[model samples]
Target: MKKILVCGMSQNLGGVECFLMNYYRNINRNKVQFDFLCNSESCAFEEEIKHLGGKVYHVCARSKNIYQFYKDVNEFFSNHAKDYDGIWVNKCMLNNIEFIKYAKRYNIPKRIIHAHNSNNMENTIKGKLQGLLHYIHRRSIHKYATDFWACSRDAGSWAFPKEIMKGENFRIIHNAIDSEKFRYNVDTRELYRKRLGLTNSFVVGHVGRFQYQKNHEFLIDIFKSIYHKNSNAVLLLIGVGELEDKIKEKVHSLSLDNAVKFLGVRNDVAQLMQAMDVFVFPSLFEGLGIALIEAQVAGLPSFTSTNVVPQEAKITNLLHYINLNESAIAWADTIVDSQAIHRELYVQASMDYNIKSAASKLELHFSNICNK
Candidate 1:
């Protein structure tokens, strides 16, 4: 059996976390087991990983304490690196390549660096400083990483050298999910709608963290326009982040307190989608918008930023693209017009995004590596 140590789980159950969990849940554990290495101790899905027979190890945050972070990381690999056959280090940016660096230093037979974002969308000083290191380290990523994986072509270009990306050692492993899990359901939708006390309202939903990358302020502005056009319009903001309070304050200041609801970190996003009339995403950039894919699977009329979010995410006809520079009213107009779309529950996402098929292929990937 091949035990693959998976890194990159964070405090939030965000897109990258969901991406990893999707594969971990679908992949055959008997053949390829997974363990987690989290920078933060309080990671999402800790209980679930333990239930699946995986171990969880914690390391200090490099951003908070770089010296101790390096010492602890080195100690971890020194003591336990031999217990695993390979390391799968997923990243939104190349700010820290030490995970792969140490993995190779310890002679882990296979070191995989998976890219999950097309750009570094950090806004803070520390983040910006760390983000600059992405450029510094990316040039030499090929030196340590034996395998390269990305969510999309754009993300691959963002993370690795062009020649390495074109080689057999690389692959575009998508942020695939259980498509059927997100398929729209009428009964479940109605149940959640009533639970939220929105039995008679036009619901505009956005699922993502209230972070710079998600552009929640723009989403709120769009919702403000939607509210003005239709007083019954209600905006449902899902997920939590560092900027949640700021977003909530903005909603309040705009006199939208009564019209917006923050439904943080939900487990039943599919059921919640049934109650929504349209899905809006105006991200600054994305590797591949996993939330957009989920919205399309739920048969929602989804709107996303063109050029910023790669076209690879638009697998269904329901997806509509608008430039981010467009006015809030312009985006609102498009989303408002989509309210009449037949909210069906039988939509099928692209087969490539299905978790079972993706899991089978990943199993073979592990088998090939372990057998080598």
Candidate 2:
């Protein structure tokens, strides 16, 4: 069996974690096994990883102490340098190169750096310094990494220089999912709606972390507009983040306590997707917006901001990209005007964003490298 060390696993419930879980669940583990190297000792996926016959190794968080972080990296590579056939590192920003450097030092033949975000979401002074460090180290990334991967074209262009991106070493890997699991199910939708006491309500749903990038404040404003238009409308907000409390307070301040439902960090997101009449995502930016694709698979009409998401995210006609500068009322009007159209799931997405095909491609890539 070929063992590949995967890095950047975390406890966070986000798009990247969802993508990893999908890939891990679908991959042919008998031929290519995966072990994780994470900053946290425990993660939401750790139990599943162990159940799948993989091990998890912890390292010190780099942001807390840089010196100790490098020390841990060095020690990890020193002890397990030759144990793995390759190293796959998933990063949101292009700013961290310590693990790739260590992998290069240990002569790891296949060092893959996968980019998962189109822009750096951090804005503080420390964040700027880290961005600077990333810029300085980026010049040598091509030298150290054997392969470059990204979730979308925009993300690829964001992380790597144009010249490197044009090379054969670069690959655009879709943020794939099990589309069949999310296919439209009228029975399931009715069941969940009744369970949540939303049988008579027109539900507008948004699934993402309550971070600045998600533009939750704007989402609330849009919901308020929709509520004014139709009193039977209800907003369903999913996922939790640092801004959850603030967003909840905003909901309360708007006197929308009864109309807006906060369903934080749900495991049954696929089932919940059924309950929504329309899905709204007004992110400031994104790598590819995996949730949008999932919503499309679930046959929900989706509205996304054009400022951040690339055109490639539109798999079906149900998805509409609108400008963020539009008024909240305008956004609400558009959502209200568009009739919800049920779509067949897994057909188009299977051609591009299905986890089985994606995992097979990765398995083949690893097999080719092992043979070489």
Candidate 3:
């Protein structure tokens, strides 16, 4: 079996984590096995990874202590780098390239740096510095990583050099999922709606961490406008982050504590999508909005920001793009009008995102690398 060490999985079940879990569950283990390496003690799908015969390792985060970070990574790679054929570094930013550096130092044949975000979401000084650090490390990535990959083209452009993005070593790996799991079903809608006590309400949903990237503050504002127009309209937020408490404060300050439900870190996201009348994703930027694609798969009418999200995300016509500069009331007006669930043509979903096909290609790629 071709064993590959997958890195950059954090504690949260965010887009990058989900992308890993989706493919991990489907890939043929006999042909290729994956062992995860995270900066934290454990990752979101720890139990599943262990159950599937995959191992999970932890290292200190570079942001917390640079010395310990280097020491831990060095010790780990020094002792265990030979256990795998390659190291796949899945990252949202290029703030740290030590994993690729160490992989190359250890002579791991295939070193991949996979990008998962288009840009930094924070507007603060720290965010700017992080962006600059990301820019500074792109050359290091180009020098050390044998393969360059991204969730989308936009993400590749953000984290890699132009030559790498256009070269043979680079590939755009679509964030494929089990689309059938998210396919709309009226029965599922009724089940979850009754369960959540939204039987007679218009449910507006969003699934993302309450971070600067996801823009939970603006989401709440738009929901406030939605509540004014129709009190029965409710917002379902699924995911929590450091900004969650602040967002809760904003929601309470707006007198919307009862109308918005904070459903954090759900395993049944597919069913949750069915209970929604609409999905709103106002992210400041994205490598690829996997949740938006899931919303589309659930056949939920979605509103998104086109300024940063790639056009490849327009898999279905149910997705609507809105400008960030527009007022919350304008967002509310558009969401309320366009989300009447008037999907005309059921387009065939037999496309590249099917998990089976992606797994096959990934396994083949890994197998080819090992054979060479």
Candidate 4:
């Protein structure tokens, strides 16, 4: 079996991690095995990776100690370079190229740089400086890496220049999911609603980490408006992060404590999705919204911010993209006016963003690379 080193694994249960897990679960592990190299010492998926016959290695974080990070990476590649045939690095920002530079030095045949985000959420001076450095490093990406990949066209265009994106080495890999698991079911909706004591309420759902990029503050504002208009309306939030407490405080200040529920980092996302009447995602920006795709698979009408999410995410007519400048009351009005139409949308999701098809295409790509 040919081994590949995969980078960017973390303890956080966010979009990038979810996309990686979906791909890992569907890929043909017998022929091509993946070993993760993460900056943190521990991650949530480590145990499951071990169970699946993969290994996880820890290195120093780049932000904490750049010199130590490089030392650890160099030592690792020096000792175990021969064990892997390739390196696939998934990065949220395109600012760091040291990983790919080291991989090239180790003579890895297939060095792949996969971009997962279109823009960084940070807007500080330090962030601007880092962006400048990213621009400098991106100029030399083709010199160190053999392959380029992204989750969407916007992501690819942001990571690489237009010329490189138009080159033959670039590939757009969709953020696919298991549509069968997310299919809408009335029985599941009833069961989850009863379990959560939401039998008589109209639930507005949002699934994402509590971060600035997700615009949870705006979502809360919109939910507050909805609650004032309809006392029976409930807002269900799933996932956790550093900003959870701050958001909770905001909810308390707005006196929306009883109307909002936060269920952090859930394993039963599909079931929870079934219980929702509408999915609201008012993100500041996104490379590709995976949760929105999952919501469509669950047959829920979704409202997202325009220019943030790509149009390719709309596999069904259930998705609606609105401008961020719109008032919270406008968002609330749209949410209330929209009616949930129950249907098995998994068939369309399967055709547009299926894990099986993605895995097969990836396997073929790897095979072709090996043949050459």
Candidate 5:
């Protein structure tokens, strides 16, 4: 069997982590044994990976001694390179160029880098600076990488423009999922919602890190508007981050303490998706918005911003998008009113976002790559 190494910044079960997990689970393990190298020492998916027959390495260097840490990582990669057939950088978080150079020194073949974020110079000042630095690094590292995988077209266009590419070594491969978990059934949804204490009231849910990038503040404003127009509505926020306190304060100021519920980092996201009637993602930008797809699989109506990837989401009956500057009140009114009348649309959305089909596509990609 050929050894395979998957490297990423963290192994925590967020969007990227979850996507990697699903990929690892579905790949042809008999032909390719897998190893995960990540910064975080412990992750929620550690046990799951171990159970599925993979080795997990905690290689994050957080010490003040930068030179020593670099030397240590270089040595570690040098020693382990012989055991791996390919090194797949999950995203551009790892020392991709350095890894490729070291892998060459050790004669490791097939260095691949995956791009997962759509951020660019146009988004933020910090993004602009990073873009300049990334451009330089990409120029330096482009030759060492055998493949550069992008998660979405938007992510590809932002990270690897035509100027940096050699015609056709880059492509978009969506993060896959296990569709069986998100099967839409009213009985199952009702049971899950009842368990979560969500009564007959219409529920709007958002599942993502409570970070500035997610635009949680704007989501809160939209929720407030929804609550104002629809008295029997509730908002459920999943996941926790640095901005949890600020979000709570906003909810309190709006006097929505009773109407909104915050369920911290959850392991049962599939269940929560089933519990939700609708999913609202107001992120400023995204690589592929996996959570929206998850909600779609659960047959829940979704709403996102215009800047998100896979613009086809707007055409899906299960999702709607509004401009960033649009009135939250109007957006909320449209969502609530349409959902009330169009009940059958939810089932169609679930079928459209079928995880099984996505997973099959991923399996094909993994097989094709290994064959090449």
Candidate 6:
């Protein structure tokens, strides 16, 4: 068996975490046993991973300067590097330079950095500076990494500009979801909506952390516009983050307490997806919108921003690309139209973006890498 070490920083149940967990569960574990290394003692996916028959090693990485953490991580890698054939780094986002460097120092044959977002690379001077540093570090460590996988083409391009264009050791592998778990069933939808007292309402749901990237302020604006036109329309914001209070305050200020509901950190996301009439994901940016694809698998119509990758926009007519400056009224108008649509075309679109298919692509890549 090829022993693989899956290392990650955060324990929060976000898009990147979800993707890693799915990969752990669905990979050909008999041929490749995975050992997870994480910073958190109680990650949201911990129990699920154990249930999947994988081993977990808690690193509990912490440091006052973050530079010290690298020294500690390097020591850990030195002691443990021989046990694993390859290392899969998840969310190698902002603060994983040291880990990458240490992997290189230890001479790991296969090091993969899987990026999950486009992440505002050109947003500010500081962002640009960091991007330059990241680009430099990535290139310096290029010899150590046998391959690079990105959740979307945009994400891949943004994170590995030179590597991708040069056709050197890069692939765009999107995040996956279990279609069996998020299957389309009308009865489940009706039952969930009725249980939630939303049987009479046209439900517009979005499942994601209340982070700046999600642009909750703009989400509230759009929800307010829709509520103003139709009081019976309900907005479901499922998932919690720093912006939760801000969003709640905005809803209260708009006197929309009844129309908008905050369901934080739900365990039944798949069932909830079925209960919705439409899914609104107007995220400013995403590596790949897993929730949007989940909505697709649930046979629910979705609307997203132009910033989201077109590949993820499974239902072309349902999706609208609007500038950030676009009014909430414009988003509302589009949502209203999306809710009115009755199309089978979207169901076909959903199948085309199945998570199993995405996993198959990854499996092929793994086979190719081992062969080479």
Pairs with steric clashes in candidate 5: none
On lDDT, the candidate that comes out on top is 1
Clashing pairs in 2: none
lDDT of 6 by residue, 20-86 (tens): 7676677776777777877656666777777877777765465444555666676788888888777
> lDDT of candidate 6 vs native?
0.73
> lDDT per residue, candidate 4, 82-148, as tens digits?
7888888998786877778888898888888998878875666877887887778778788998889
Question: How does each model score on TM-score?
Answer: 0.97, 0.96, 0.96, 0.96, 0.88, 0.89
**Alpha-carbon error at 188 in model 1, in Å?**
0.9
Give one digit per residue, the lDDT tens place, for model 1 in 1-372.
899999999888889998889999999999999999999968889999999999999999987898989999999999999999999999999988899999999999899999999888788997789789998889999899989999999999999888988899999887788888988878888898899988999999999987899999999999999999999999998899889999999999999999999988999887898888899999999999998988898888999999999889998899999999899999998888887778866778777899999999998998897677
lDDT of 2 by residue, 167-281 (tens): 9889888888898899888899899999999999989999998877789999999999999989999999999988899999999999999999999999999999999999999
Judged by whole-model lDDT over C-alpha atoms, candidate 5 comes out at: 0.72
- Regions more than 4 Å wrong, model 1: none
Say which prediction, candidate 2 or candidate 6, comes out ahead on lDDT: 2
Off by over 4 Å in 5: 9-11, 62-65, 92-101, 120-132, 163-166, 312-315, 344-372
RMSD of each: 1.2, 1.6, 1.6, 1.6, 3.1, 2.8
Writing each residue's lDDT as its tens digit, candidate 5 over 125-157 gives 755666677777666656677777877777766
Off by over 4 Å in 3: 343-350
Q: Report every candidate's CA lDDT.
A: 0.90, 0.87, 0.88, 0.86, 0.72, 0.73
Better of 2 and 6 by TM-score: 2
lDDT (0-100) at residue 142 of candidate 4?
A: 88
Off by over 4 Å in 2: 340-348
